[model samples]
Target: MLNHEVYHKFAPNQQYSYALSYRRQNVYDEKAPYHNEGVEQEFRLYGRYAYTFKLSERWKWKNTLRQEFRKFLLQTFTRQKRIFSLEPD
Candidate 1:
């Protein structure tokens, strides 16, 4: 698997930020049941927003919201499935 991301800070105080990322994965198995002789591929695109604040002089709190778009493919690159997800942390 491989991933790359770019991030931007929206506030000079660094309280707000956003990022965009891309990921790719390759799977291999000899005894699996799906996708081109047990080999599969996946690709993903992600976007995230984050906010941070001070909880105390020595502590901080952060929250993040993320969205993902993903696709699965056979080893030959034929599309198999598409998925979308939203997550908060």
Candidate 2:
């Protein structure tokens, strides 16, 4: 497994970030009974954006949005999954 991430702050209460990751799973093993004789490798990428505001002296508001994408490699049939998330305050 390998992972890398990058982040930036546009303002005191605002920020943006990105992440990349790679993983390999042994879908089949020679010693296993059910063996497909193949391995599955997944590559994932993620991005996020967030901002916050001071609503009051003791109150704060925040919003965040994130997205993710995945790709499969070294597989007979390539598959991918995508996800999105949002948070508001």
lDDT of the candidates, in the order given: 0.61, 0.76
Instruction: Give candidate 1 regions above 4 Å deviation.
Output: 12-37, 81-89
Clash counts per candidate, in order, are 0, 0
Judged by whole-model lDDT over C-alpha atoms, candidate 2 comes out at 0.76
TM-score of 1: 0.63
Off by over 4 Å in 2: 28-37, 52-63, 75-89
Tens digit per residue, CA lDDT, model 2, 1-89: 99998989989999999999888877766585876767677777889899999899999998989888777776554553422223221
User: Which run of 10 residues does model 2 get worst, by summed lDDT?
Assistant: 80-89
| Winner by TM-score | 1
Best by lDDT: 2
Backbone clash pairs for candidate 1 read none
TM-score of each: 0.63, 0.56
Model 1 over residues 10-77: C-alpha lDDT tens digits? Answer: 77435333344444455545575634444456666777777778789899887877776666677677
| Clashing residue pairs, backbone N/CA/C < 3 A, model 2 | none
- Range of the 10 consecutive residues with the lowest summed lDDT in candidate 1: 13-22
What is the Cα-based TM-score of model 2? 0.56
